[model samples]
Structure formats: C-alpha cells, structure tokens
Target: MDLLDFARGPAINVAMAVLVFGVLWRLFALLFLGKPVDRTIPRLGTPGPFWAGLREIGRRMLPHPTFATAERFAFFNGWVFHVGLAIVVFGFRPHILFIKNLTGLSWPALPSGVIYAVGAITALSLIAALVKRITSPVQRFISTFDDYFTWVVTIAPVLTGLAAVGHVGARYETLLAIHILSIAVLLIWLPFGKLFHAFLVFLSRGQTGAFLARRGV
Candidate 1:
C-alpha cells in the first residue's frame, strides 16, 4: 500500500480501538465501583419519577427553571465552557472528515474562527476550574488524586489541539501526530481516573433528582 493508505489504516484502527476499549472499561468500572442510589446527594425541593430528573436537566438548560438560583454567572460560565468544549472537540472539520471516512457518517463542521474561539474559551475555563479547586479550601479538601488526574487528562487534548493548530515546533503533520498521541493517552487514562465522572454525571444527576422528587424535597 502507498504511505497514505498505510497511515490511514493504522490511524483508523488505533483510534477505534482506543474509543471502544475506553468506553467499555468506563462502563464496567461504573457498574462495579459507582456508588448506589442512596449514596448520591439529591437536590432539595425536587418532585418524583424519571421526569423529575429530566426536569432537573431542563432547569439547568433553561434560562430560568423553577430551581434556578442566583448564581447566574457561575451557571452561564459553566454551560458556555462545556458547550464550547463540545463544539470544538466534536465539530472540528478534520474530526468530521475522519468520522465520515471511518464510520460512513458526517456532520457539519464549525467555522475555523468559531472552533478556535471555543478552544480558547474551554482552555480558559478549565484553567479557572483548576485554580478554583486549588484556592477553595472546601474544594481542595474534597478533591482526591483522581480529581487532579482528571484535570490533567482533560486539559491534555485541548493543549495538544492548540499546539497542532499553531505548529510551533514542527511541521503540521508532526503537530498532528502529537495531538493524536495526547488524545490516545487521554483515552487510555479515562477509565482509570475521575474522568469517568464525565459519563456518570448524567446518570447520577438523574437518579439523585428523582429520589429527591419522591421524598417531596
């Protein structure tokens, strides 16, 4: 095979392997190690059923839900950070092309400027969060090694992505290689660290909200 064909095959295979294994490992670990329903803290004043959880998520999403609190800036910043990060990670042109080529699916790509803006915002937000964790006594006390590991792992992809775009030390292809390697490291680390919370957060939020609703709190 030509160099292009050979490179494509291994790139696709490695990426697929990492994705599949990372997901499975996370699923199994959560199944085995995740705390039971009663262990989760529920939101106060929630009402019961699966809908309660849905309502909680809706409240978080909406401009003003019944459970809305006065911490408007915090909520807005957090949401913006998450949404922007998602857009950059999942809506990059190269990523879309890779997915379409490998999986026979495609999505619209974000504009380059928008993607760069999202990357910048997400990186800033992550740094702010890390600082918060270090400076806040309560957060510092609550954080475990896993939490720190998650922060590093999560930040790696963003940093590498920026480096790939900037191409500071090497050719574009070399920067891309570094970016892919960082991503691979993150995938391998995800299951073994607090990064697993990325998946568990949704389920835990839902279950906790539902339970609170049942208690009429």
Candidate 2:
C-alpha cells in the first residue's frame, strides 16, 4: 500500500487496536493490584468520599492562589495546550467524521479556520513547554529520556497537522499522511508511557482526596 493508504487505513487501525487493548489491560491491572482496603471511618462533618474526590478533581485543575505567582505561567500554558489540542483533535470536520464512522454518532464541527487557529495555539504552547523543560534548572534536573520521548510523541501530531494545514514543505497529501502516521505513533505510545497520566490523573486525584477525607485531613 502507498504511504497515505497505509497511514490512514491499516496503520491507524492497528494503532487504535493497540491503544484500546493496552489501555484496558493497564486499567485492569490497576484494578487487580492488591492494595489493602481502607478501613478508616470517614470523618463526620466532611463531604462524603465520592463528592470530596470529585471536588478535589475540579479544584486541582485550577491554580491555587498560594502557588499562582510561582506556577502561573506553567499552569496557563499547560491549560492552553491541553484545551487547544482537544479542540484541534475533536473539533475538526475530518476527525468528527472519523468518530462518526467509528461510533455511529456525529457532532457539529467548528470551522476549518477555527481548527487551524487552535492547532497553532497548541503548537506554540507545546513548544514553549518543551523549552521550559529543557532550560529550567529544576525541570532539567528531573528530566529523563521518557520525559523527552513523551514530549516528542505528544507534539509530533500537532506539528505535522499544522504543516499539513499550511501546505508546508510538501504536498498536502504527503503532509496529511505524515500527520496521520504521527498520530498513530502517539496512539501506540500513549497507553505505555507518561501520556497514560491523562487517563490516570483523575484516579490518582480521587484516591488522594478520598484517603484524606477518610483520615479527617
């Protein structure tokens, strides 16, 4: 098969399958891992554990005033990148069509121009975050190969997508193929790498808050 056909057809199909299977496997493993059940009685006068967990998830999504001055830039850029990336991924016409094909549901898509704008913003924010990771002493000290690998896999689709949209350095078809291939790589990488945090973040936050509430903290 040609590059475009392979990318959009067999390669993407395999990537999707791997993504689904890997994520399910990881989640089940987490479920079955033998952790002792919490036996502590929940504190009276506190929100119930479930509500506390949900509340904490929402609360931690925004920057707290205590750390706002120090982490405001990181928080802002991270939010922009995530929100913009979501829009670019899910709000494009082709992507909406793809989802419809998979799930037999369709949603209205934003204009192509709006998608391109969100893609641009996501790309810029991702680049800035990468730069900060490399340049900041503390961040660099904590960086590892996996961190950089995750960043590359995370950003490749955005870069190639923007390139495809702009018709840069190649035919639009070629760039689109590259973009699809990059996304395939991302799908495969996600369940096995730090990107899994996107799925696990809520679980982790909920567990923490639940535990704290049970202990009357």
Candidate 3:
C-alpha cells in the first residue's frame, strides 16, 4: 500500500485499538493489583474523602503558592503547550469529524485560521521545551531514552500538521500521511511511557488526596 493508504487504514486502526485496549488494561491492572481493604473511620465533622479528593484535584490544577515561584517556567510553558495542543487536536474540523464518526459525538470546530495559528505556536513551544530539556544540566542529567523519544513523538504531529496545512516541503497528501503516521506512533506510545501521565494525572491526584484526607490530613 502507499504511505497515505497505509496511514489512513491499517496503521490508524491498529494504533487506535492498541491505544484503547492498552490504556484500559493498564488502568485495570493499576486498580486491581493493589487491592486493599479499607477499615478506617473518618473523624467526626471531617469532609468526605471523595469530596476532599475532588477538591484537591481541582486545587492542584492551579499553581500552588508554596511552589509557584520555583515552578514558574514549568507552569507557564506547560500550560501553553497543553492548551495549544488541546485546541489543535480537539478543535480542528477534521478531528471533530473523526470524533463524530467514532463516538457519535460532534462539536463545532474553530476556524482553520485559528487552528493553524495555535498549532504553529504549540509546535514552537514543544521545540523550545525540548531545547531546554537538552540544555539544562539538571534536566539533561535526568533525561532518559523515553524522554527524548517522547519529545520526538509528541513534536512530530505538530510539525507535520503545520507542514500539511502550509503545503510546505512536500505534496499535501504526503505531509498528511506523515502527520497521520506520527499520530499513530503517538497513540501507540501513549500508554507505555511518560505519556501515560496524560491518563494517570487525575487518578493519581485524586487517590493521593483521598488517601491523605482519610487520615484527617
């Protein structure tokens, strides 16, 4: 099959299956492996653990006062990349169509112009983040194969998407094929490494806070 046909058909299907099942399996394993019986009672007048956990999860989404100064760069760049990425992924017309096809859910998309602008900005942010990770002594020292691999996989879609949008460096069809292939790679990678944090963040935050709140902390 040609690259475009492969990217649009078998590659996408297999990648999506792997993404869905792999994520579900991992989540099930995490939930069931550490099965524990809770026998502790809450203090009188204490907030319920569930609500407290939800509160903590929401609260933690904002920068904490104690660590805000130290984490300023992370908070700023992280939000920029994440928000921009979200817009590009979920607000693009084609992506909305794909979602509608897959899940019978549809939402209005942002203008193509807006999507292009956000995508370009997100691509730059990702590149900047990669450079920082490579150059900073601390970040570089702590980097692993997964770190660099994740960076490449994450950035590929953005670059290819922009290329396809701008009709740069290749035919639009070829650029789109590359973009789709990159996304498939990203899907397959998501459940396996640091990218798992995308799924785990809410669960981790909630569980951590609930555990602490159960002890009246």
Candidate 4:
C-alpha cells in the first residue's frame, strides 16, 4: 500500500470511526446530565421554550451589543473562514463526490478554480484569526492549548489542500496524501476538542435560552 492508499483507507476509516464514537459519547454525556425540571410557570406574553429558545439562538449568533464593536474583527473573520470552508467542502466537485461516496448523496459543484480560490482565502482568514488570538491580550490570556491545537487541525487541511491543488511543496500525489491525512487528523480530534462546538453550540445556546426564557428574562 502507498501513502495515498493509507490516507484514503485506514487513516480516514479510523478517523471516521473515532469521529462517530467520540461525537456520540460526548452527546450521550450531555444527555445524561439531564436538565432539571422547570417548575416555574412561564410568564405570559412571552414565547415559550421552543420559540424563545430558537429566537435566542439566532439572536446570540451576533455578539452582544456591549462588545459588538470590539468583536467585529474576530466575528467577521470567523464567518469568512467558516463560510469559505463550507463552500470548498461542499461546492467542489471532488469533495461532493467524496461526500457522495460516503453517504450516497450528491450535489452540483462550483468550478474547481473558484473553490480553490476560496480555499486560499479561507487559509488567510484562519491565519488572521490566529494573529488576533495572539495579539489580543484578553483572548491570549484566555486561550488554552486546545485553542491553538484546534486551530492547527482546522487549518492544516486547508493549507495542505492548497498545496495539493497548486502541486507545490511536493509531487501532487504526495501533497494530496498529506492533505487527506490532515483532514483525517482533524476528524479524529474534532469531537475531542474545542472543535466539537461545531455541533454543541446550538445545543448549549438553546438550553440556556430555554432556561432563561422560562423566567421571562
């Protein structure tokens, strides 16, 4: 077996297995920590848990007014890379084919050149985010190993993908192998790290919103 074989086979298979198991484990852990029963009667003239929680989740997607101005850079930068990542992953023909292979789903793809350009832009956004994390005193102080580690795993695939697409730094085959391996690493680490927030953010925000909404706060 060759490098590409290893990356496309065992590495990805194990990473996906770990991803599924870890996500399920984390979710089960949260579920087991059951919410306490709410005994308080909800105040009148307010949307109940379902609507209030949904609204609050949407509301908090933006930074609070108190810090919105201060957080604008980080906020917009985050959205930039996140949206770029989505476009590259789902809009590229090869990626859509990969997803189809895994799940028997297919979608139209954007032009390869367009998706690759977006990948480059995504890489820049990630780098900008890293710089902000380092330069901002409060963010720097609050940051932990997980923060930087997650960032690396997040950016590694993007960087490697660009290299593979450009056929730079190595033979195209080798670069592609590296890119796939980086993604495998990302998948393995995602559920075990801060990256899990990709899924958890909604659960957590909705729970809080439901709790607070019951009190009409």
Residue-wise lDDT of candidate 3 within 148-180, one digit each (tens)? 999899999999999999999999999999999
lDDT of 4 by residue, 1-217 (tens): 9999999999999999999999999999989987787687888788877888898899987999999998899889988999999999899888898889999999889999899899999999999999999999999999999999999999999999999989988999999999999999999999999999988998888878887887888
Q: What is the overall TM-score of model 1 with all chains considered together?
A: 0.75
Q: Model 4 compared with the native: what TM-score? A: 0.96
Q: Per-residue lDDT of 1-217 in model 1, one digit per residue for the tens?
A: 5433433456546755876788787688767885555655555655556898887666556556543574454566778778877898789998788668768888888898788888988989888888877987887999999889877877777887887797767777766766766666676676667766667777777866677686675
Q: List, residue by residue over 1-217, the lDDT tens digit for candidate 2.
A: 8899999899999999999999999999998897797776778888887988998899899988999998988999999999998998889999889889899888889999999988988988999999999889999999999899999998899999989989999999999999999999999999999999988999999878877877777
- Best candidate, TM-score-wise? 4
lDDT of 3: 0.91
Query: lDDT of model 3 at residue 115?
Result: 96
Off by over 4 Å in 4: none
User: Model 2: residues >4 Å from true position, as ranges?
Assistant: none
Q: Which ranges of candidate 3 are over 4 A from the true structure?
A: 38-45
Candidate ranking (lDDT, best to worst): 4, 2, 3, 1
Q: Report, for every candidate in turn, its global Cα lDDT versus the true structure.
A: 0.73, 0.91, 0.91, 0.92
Could you tell which candidate, 1 or 4, scores higher by TM-score? 4
TM-scores for all candidates: the values are: 0.75, 0.95, 0.93, 0.96
Clash number for each model: 4, 0, 0, 0
lDDT of 4: 0.92
* RMSD (Å) of each candidate, 1 decimal: 5.2, 1.3, 1.6, 1.1
Best of the two (1, 2) by TM-score: 2
